[model samples]
Structures are given as C-alpha cells and as structure tokens.
Target: MGVATQLVVALAIMCAVLLAVAFFLLPSRSNKRKGLIQIVVLGDLGRSPRMQYHALSIAKYGGHVDMIGYLESDPLPELKAHPNVNIIALPNSPRVLQTGSKLVFIVTAPLKVMLQAWSLWSVLAYKTEASEWMLIQNPPSIPTLLLAIIVCYFRKTKLVIDWHNFGYSILALKLGRNHPLVRFSKVYEQLLGKFATAHFAVTDAMGKVLRSDFAISSPVLSLHDRPAPLFVPLLPSERIAFLTQHELTAAEANEIIDGNTKLIVSSTSWTPDEDFSVLLKALCEYSTSAITDSPQLPELLVIITGKGPLKQHYINEIEALDAKQELEMVTIKTAWLSFEHYASLLGVADLGVSLHTSSSGVDLPMKVVDMFGAGIPVVGYSNFKAWSELVQENVNGKGFTDAEEMAGVLKSLFDPANNQLDVLREGALKESKRRWDSEWKPIAGRLFELTT
Candidate 1:
C-alpha cells in the first residue's frame, strides 16, 4: 500500500465522523412538532383538586394537554371547557385496598399493579412524539408511578411525579405501622421516586422528605395547592342569600347577626386521616362549658361539608345526638356539597376548622387554603411541620393537638367581645392574597421547562 492510498482512507474516515456528529447534534423532527403535555392521574380525577388545577394551569399557556384518570369523581367544568384540554375518562376500578382490610391490600398488590400498568400502558402506547411529558399524581396507588417510569423509559418521554403523600403512610392508617405491606410500600415509593425526571412536592416539608428518605437529587419543585378562582370573599347580601338558600330562615339569619347564633364550618373528605370525631368531640366540649354568662356565646350552627366512606357513620352519630335533643348549645348538620356551595359556605362562615393531621405527616391540607381564601380563620389539628405551614398559631389560624384544646380554641374565636376573630380573619385574607396571588401559572411554566 502506498502513502497516497493511506491518505484517501483517512479522509473518508474523517468525513464519516463529521456526518455522524451532524446527525446527532441536529434537532429531531419531534422537536419541530407542536409540543403537547400529558397528565396521567390514577386517582379519582373529579375529586382531586390538584389534578384539576394542574390541567387548568397547563391550559393557561395555550398548550395542548391530555388527562387520563379514573371516572369515580366528576371532571372539573373549567377543564372540560378548556379548548386545549382533552380529558380521557377510564372506568373506575374497585380499590380493594383503600376500602378493604390490610390482608386484602397485600393479597391484591400484584394484581393491582398489573391492572394499573396495563391501563397506563394502553394510553401511553399512543404517544408518538419524543420529548413529550406526563405529570403523574400519586399516593393511593404508588406503583402507578413505577408504571409511568417504565412507559417513559421506552417512549423517551419525560416523567414527573407530583408527590402529595407517601402511600405507605396512608396504608399504615389501616394496616399497623409494622405491617410488612406498609414497609414494602415505603421502600418501593422511595426507590421509584428517584427515577422521575422531576418531582413536585405539595409542601416544602414533603420536598425534604423526598430528599432525605428517597435520596432524590432530581429537580424537586414545591407546588402548593391554592384557592380556586371561585373562593373569593362574599358580599353581605351574598352571604345572607347563601345561608337562606341552605334553609336559614330570616329569623335565624337575624339571630346569627344579633349574636344569638353563630355558623361554624369545616370541610373534610371523611377519611381515616381526617378525624371528624375530633371536631365533634370539641363541639361537645364547647357545648358543655359555661365559659360565659351571656347567651351571646351564640347557639352554634355547625355545618360539616364533604362526602366520604365514613360520612354515614358521622351522620348517624349527629342524628343520635339530635335525637337526644339535650345539646341545645349546638346543632349539627352534614352536607356533601358541590365546590360552588362549599366555597360559598367558606365565604360566609365565621370560622373554619380542619381535622386533618396530614395522612403522610408531610402533605398540607387544601381545605385550609380555601378557608384562608374566603378570609375565614381556621383551627386545625397540628402535625407540626405540614399543618404548621398554614395554621401559624394565632396568625392566620390556630393549631390544636386534641379535642379539648380545639374546643378551647373554638370558644375563644366565638367570643363576641374579644375581637380576636376579626384580627384572625384579616390575617387569613392577607396571607391568602400573598400566597394564592402568585398563581400556579408560573409553577406550570417551570414544570413545562422540564420538557426542554
């Protein structure tokens, strides 16, 4: 072989290398296509406000969004009305674990995961574009995240997990903390959480847990739930109308204003995590106490909103109390209200109470957020880190550990002369303005950047 022949071979090799580099560096045809974001929530879509808010946020940017979730709950009208959003409703699967015993959950874990994987895989299989993204809401079924991770891996799509709470912590409420299934769930959650392209925490404390427990160095964003657009403070007339519409007679409305009666509201999902009994027990304690000689401590009109599995149990307890007719200091009423009605109640109520202690000890309750938006003060049970973020003792709201403490908090708030409730109402409004005014649009914008 001659030197000239060797030179020709080197030149050909160099040309081939340059051509390969160009092909690799150049943008693919997928990037040239319209960018669309996909969101898959295995949980109840109609019930999950977080999922509804996420869909609305994505639509704000005029980006196309495809939402896939269970049909157990009703879809948000706002999401349905959005031109850029397409909600894919799947038949609600029987959640054997959530409603059944620990033994049932453990026994059905394999089947549950397989079913979820198949549901997710069926929809994800149609994603034809690369660099597409999916934000998944988690907790009741943790393995759904694992399924999303696998689907994303094969499709080269970006995967984001919005961690509301750990599934194990919730499972522990039914199964004891020492249950092997709970232990396995905790391990699985932490291990799988790290595989996501990014993580969104419901609270800062939740983000820390992801870091400490999961060792997730992935980009974690704290995307807290805020008040919906409809949660504004009510006008005097609007408040009266809301009360009247709910069977408050003109005389009763006058009594409320004259300090002969007061309306207290609390919203709950009726889950084990939310101990509604705590609020009821507190009301019982408050009713028995002769804290003041004046009748103006006000005969209580306690309204509890939300529908859940335990709703019937609480309703029966309230009815039994009503049957006794001995507790004249307070009257109990339970309602499974629509968001509009719920927001109106929050807007008109004098005080709001939250019995949620954070099922995971990390996720903050959105009920307090809605209350704050309506300029209603809250007295929520303390879980220390998560609930404390919103209910800053005497700032926007108060925190209690037990029913006795909660009763005491309620007593002070109901005191007509103290003017403490007025100050707390103002604080709640101020905090709500500061927090919710920021909006989820910017947060969604940052999340969309993950696709880039």
Candidate 2:
C-alpha cells in the first residue's frame, strides 16, 4: 500500500474509534426513564411566592410537571426551564357560559378545568405508564377542586393540597365569618383534609392551625418559605454598584456613609392593607421636621418598587404628601424581575419596610425574606405572630404595631452613634443561612419526595 493511502486509513480508523467511544459514554434512550411521578400544579402562575417556590423545587427535583395556571397580562421574565417541565397556560380571558340556571357552574367550571387538565394528563399518563399525582398549590376554585377530586377518584391518583395561606380565615376577615364564602371555604377545606393524601403548609404555625381548626386527617407537612438562593456573592463594591444602577449618584452613596441621607425602601405590590400611604405620611412628617438638638437628619428618600391595583392610589398619596420634592419617593413599576435581580435591589437598600394593619393577619411578605437574604434590616408592623417570631429570633429587624413605632424604629436604625447596624447585618446573614437549612431545605425535600 502507498504511504499516503495507509495514513488516510489510519486517520479514518482513529476517527471511527473516537466516535464509538463517545456513543458509549452518551446516555442511551433506554436509560432515560420517564419520570416516576407527574405533577399537575394549579394556581396563578404570575409572580407569586407559592408558585415560584413550588416551580423551582420541581425544576431542581426529578419530575414531569404540568403547570396549569393563569399567566399575568403583562410579560413576565422567563423562568429557568428543566427537561421535565411543561407549562400549560390557562385561559387568561374570562370564561362565559350561557345558562339561566344557577346550577350551570355545577356542570360548567369543573367540566372546563377537567377537560383542560385531561388533555395534558392523558398524554403524560399514556407515555409515563404511571399513576399521576395532582398537587393544588393554592386553593382551587370550588368548582375546579370538585373537578380535580372527581378526576383523582376516577384515576386512583394521589392528591396533595398545598395550603399557602389560611384562605378560610382570610375570607372570614374580609367578609364576616358568617358570610357564605367563608363557610363554604371551611367546608371545602375540611373536604380536602379528608380526601387529600398529603397537606403542605408554608409554616409550622400554619400546619398546626390546619390540623387543629380544620380537623384534617391527612399528615400535615411544613413547607416553610424558602426564597430562591443567592447565586452571586455580593461584595461591598457590587452592592454600591447596584445602588448606582438604580440611579443613586456617587454623592448619594457617600451620604449613606456620612449619615447625611437616609434611604427607606419598601419593595412590594402596593396593597391598601399594607398601608403604604401611612408610611408615606410618617416619612413626610419626619422629613419636614427640624432636627434642633439631634445630629443632622438624613435626607429621607423612599424608593417604592412595585405596582398593583392600588398603584394609582399610592401615587396619589405620594403626590399629596409632596414626597417628590422633600422625600424623593420614586416608584418603579418593575412588576416582573428575576429572583436574582430583585434580591440585588433589596441587598443595596438601607432599610426594608412592610406594614400590615390589624385587618391583615398571619401575612408573611416574601419581600421580608428577600430583605433577610440581602442582609438588610426590616422594619414593619408586628401584627402577625410569625412575623414577630422571625424578627425577634433573627435580631436582624424590628417590628411595631403602628406608624409611630415604625417611624421610631427607622430613626433608630439610621442613627450613626447606635453602631448596631453591624450587629444587625451579621445577625441577618446568620439568620438567612439558618432559615435556608431549617425551613427551606426540609420543605423542598418534601416537595421533591411528592414529585418523585
């Protein structure tokens, strides 16, 4: 054989050998088993704490998830995708049925949701060759729940109800306890308690309330609130940069250090019950007052970053306060931010504020967790026991009952001589880790087990 011909043959042989080795190392079609469990998540897929937490857990863990939910009218940031994840967007438009009979819902709503769910479930059921699991992340509409229950019963599938909040209690608070909706929710919850294979609550307090109040037979699991983990380590320089990115000038950054300016940040969907207007009035009052004996008061700046139904109302209140001239109350309509982006914003904030009135009970704001992760001190109304416990245990934040106390706490936090800022920062970081381990991980593990 000619030398060139022999060399060509050798090269070809080497190429074939490498290809064969690569093929053997690669995952085979048979090795890729269809996930053992199929989870159907029913909720509003818009940026909600419960939905985000469950979706992330499903992505990390192994499962084929069919997310059937309502998408926000506004565009949302793309969520991290997983191989097993399938998003089935629910109809955003209102459902209309032509019927004079009140009993129409008895036939219509369930039929619609079931038909929609069945379309996806049928495909997964045949392909996976496994009994599917249905997880209702939030309280489904009564008709929807009824349909799900009927489907589960027929399919012999296990049902898991994740009680994100005490909906029945909320209903009672909003509408009198004697209201039909409140009573109906109670019955609905009891029915779910009896039928569901498992019940997951966001906090131990929530779980205990379920077991005691609802007489639920299913084993109650505490799936505590776990904010998404911080992927990027935040350095001091990076924190300053984050502030600048949001439009804080170099002089303002120096003012933060020199204690010549104070920035109070409250980043949440502005709701009437949250009482942003009250906070605005307090800050306005504080800012206009002269500091005679005390050291120069920091130039108060309130940065509000979210929008909701109450956005216009808050805008009107801020304008009324004339916070634009004196307080620099800037409202950023950033309804859609990736978890990381939101955390970075919170991290640079000097103080985080969230207040709930007496009417708002047992509410734990997700922004509070973001603040904790950012090592930012939180000052808010302490109406809820859970909030009080977290703030007290962490020693990273302070809580109060009303606007006066809240204002007092903010004054103390921004005080230069206090030297307690470092202590709070250290405490917040420690508590963040403790919360991740004790609360977040176990809940995530439980969700993993359910999905797998």
Candidate 3:
C-alpha cells in the first residue's frame, strides 16, 4: 500500500475506536445512578407536615434523601421505614411547648439560626455530593436560606425552596405588620427567593405572588398536600375494636353508631391565627336550636384535636360549657391524637369542621385535606384564596364567615331529613380520588425534574 493511503486508513481506525469508547462510557455513567437522585431536606422537618410529605415523595421515587430536621415527638415510622431515606434529627427543632415563651424565641432567633446553620454547614461540607440538591422549607425564612445560598454556592449544588408561607407574614402575626423586623423579612424573602434554582408553592395563588410580588425568576412548581393512604373507612370489625379499645360503654358506642349521633371533628395548632372559639359559639347555637322537640334530631358530639398556647383556655371553656349541661343535644370532647388514631377518627366521623382562617391569608389549612381524604364532609371558613379551591358551599362542603352563619351551616349539615351531608361526602370522595390519581402525582413529579 502507498504511504499516504496507509496513513489515512490508520487515522480513520483511531477515530472509530475513540467514538466507540465515548459511546460506551456515556451510558455506563448515566446508568450507574439507575435514575436515582440524591436529595437533602433542610427545614422544620418533624413538625412541618408539608416538609415530611416532600421527603416521602423523594424516597418513594427512588431518591436517596438525607433529611436534616428535628423530632418534636416520636419519629414518623413510615418515613423511618423507607430504605432510601435517612432522618438526621437536629437539636434545635423541638415542639412549641419546649420553646418557652414567644418573646424568648423571638429574642434568641438570630443565635438559634447561627447555631443551626453551623450544624447544617458541617453536614453539607462532609457528606453532600456535587449532584445532590438541598430542598429547603421556608418561613423561619432568612437564616436557613442565607446559609443554603452560602453552602450551595461553595458545593456547586442547586438549592430548591418549597415556600409554605412568608416568614415575614408570620412576624406580622406576632409583631404588627409595620414592625421593622417584618419589613426586613419581606425584603429578605424577596431577595433570597431569587437564589433558589427552583421554587415549589403549596398553592397556585402563592406561585403567582412569588412571580409578581417577590419577582422570583426561578422555575416555580405548585405541589399541594395529598391525603395519606391511611385515611380510609374502617371495616365493621375494626370500628368495633376501636370503640372497645377506647373503653367506650355499650350505650356510648350506640350513641356514636346505631344512634346516628352526628360526630363532628376539628383540628388546630391552637395558635392565635385560628379562632377556635368561633367553633365553640357555633356549637352553643347548635345545642340551643335542638330544643325544638324534634324526635328525629341526631345527638351531636364535637371532637377537637391538638395542643397549643390557648389549649388550656379552650379546655377550660369547654369544661365549663359541659358542666352547664345546657347543651342537651350536644357533647364535647378534645384530645391530642397520634396519626393512626387521628385517621381512625376521621374515618368514623360523620363530618369535619375547620376553624382555620389562615395565619396570613396565604396558605390553606391541612386539616381540611385530611377530612376530604376520609370521605367526610367539612364545614370550612373561607378566609383565603386557596380555601375557595377546596371548599364550595353545598358542594364538597359548606363555608361561612361568622359564628352565627357557621352555626346555621352546621345545623343544616347535621339535619336528619336533609341529604346535604351525604351529597357533600360523595363530592369529597370524588375530589379526594381525583386529587390522588390525576392532580398530585404530576405536580410532585416536578421535584424530580429539578435534578435533571
């Protein structure tokens, strides 16, 4: 062969070998991950319901999640059991009761953030991978985001923020809206939100505000909370066992079951944001109107759940009301239930009432979502934009403004002859199923898209 021809053929052969090697290495590197993404969650972990849900979604989608959060009570078994998730509880995230007074918490807030940021920095420096993302929950807002911006900048990792509510709006709740701290929080949130690569809002309304008001140019996703799988009707035997376990007498069981007593359940965090006393006044009105001597009137039972600052005051009020014995047709009960027990209560209850008026008129209450999952009709107060999406008068449930109107709606729901409750319950079931099958998965899928 000629020297020129031999040289050209050898060069072509070398090119072919290089192309083959490149193709081989590409798929091998991509397939090595098996589509698994590594995510680290930093937030008010154990206490925040939405944050916990986010972690569960990541773990379920084959992601390796390092959840850096605090444990307020017992650890959630479902999250702990997931093989892909590791729960790294921090020292500062404790229950509200453990935090002493609101004033003390406010005074020491900066120091608390510094300590927590230092702890988080150590974890990210030693353990984080280049491809890993830091998903943070906001409102306690600036400190965490500032720390994330610093750490992620150094690590060359992306920061994703799941905005629940603005931390400044919460400050407005405690301090006045005009407070200098509140102003600072507002400016800081707007500025720091731009630092995130992606932002997820719990409601679409919040998303609009993020773009228009906060001017966050990052990719924004809306992922609302879905019903946990556990919220479902109890089997006949399971209902009987639950009653027996609670040590309910035969007559009490009959009152709940065969007696057709309308069981109304409500939950709250007992903060100033929620005016549970409005629910109390409505119950009073309900009991007063029951004196009409209608033989078909189903007895009423109100069950309130959760512990907070005003819990003792409300407990005292409820006890005094119970002692008065003027509520001939109504009975009251309250307890701080575990997740399993809470779901069971929702399953068996005839209806649920939500007294949430929104802390800042930005976020929707989660209690209503739990009720819808159990196929229980709810009476909710329409105080925010998101509630309008979840609640409809005489459709899925009823909404009201004041105690008197709320009382009237409650009576109409519990009225024996009317089929309103049944119709609303059916709507709730349909909405719940639709939310699970069609709505939630696609929105939640957005989180995975961020890693790509």
Best model per lDDT: 1
Each candidate's clash count: 0, 0, 0
Give the alpha-carbon lDDT of every model: 0.74, 0.57, 0.70
Task: Kindly provide the TM-score of model 1 when superposed on the true structure, using C-alpha atoms.
Answer: 0.86
| 1-452: candidate 2 lDDT, tens digit per residue | 65533543464445446434543453322222334333444444655655655655555565566655655632123443555556655544345632323345323433444444444333333333334566776544343454455546655667777766655665454456775546766787666566877778766677777787778877888766645566223688887786666553344666654556665667765544577766765675555442434444566656676656577776776666563564442222223355556667677667777765533254467677767777777777777756764576327877777666665666666666786666777777665664443454465456546332
| After superposition, candidate 2 runs with Cα above 4 Å error | 1-43, 73-79, 95-131, 140-144, 172-174, 231-233, 247-254, 257-259, 290-295, 323-336, 357-360, 435-452
Per-residue lDDT for 1-452 in model 3, tens only?
Answer: 55533543464445445434533342211112322333444444545666666667777666667777666654467987988777776666334324545465554454455456556655554444444577787766756677677666755566888787788987787767875567878998999889998988878889899999999888888877667676776677877666546632234666776747777889887877788888888887778888764446678877888777788888888888878875677777778777888888887778888888776576878888888888888898886777876777677888888999998887777778878888998888776664432344576555565232
Residue 130 of model 1 has an lDDT of 43
What are the RMSDs of all candidates, in order?
A: 12.4, 17.1, 15.0
Can you give the lDDT of residue 112 in candidate 1?
A: 56
Our model 3 lands, by Cα RMSD against the true structure, at 15.0
Candidate ranking (lDDT, best to worst): 1, 3, 2
Summing lDDT over every window of 10 consecutive residues in candidate 2, give the lowest-scoring window: 26-35
Better of 2 and 3 by TM-score: 3
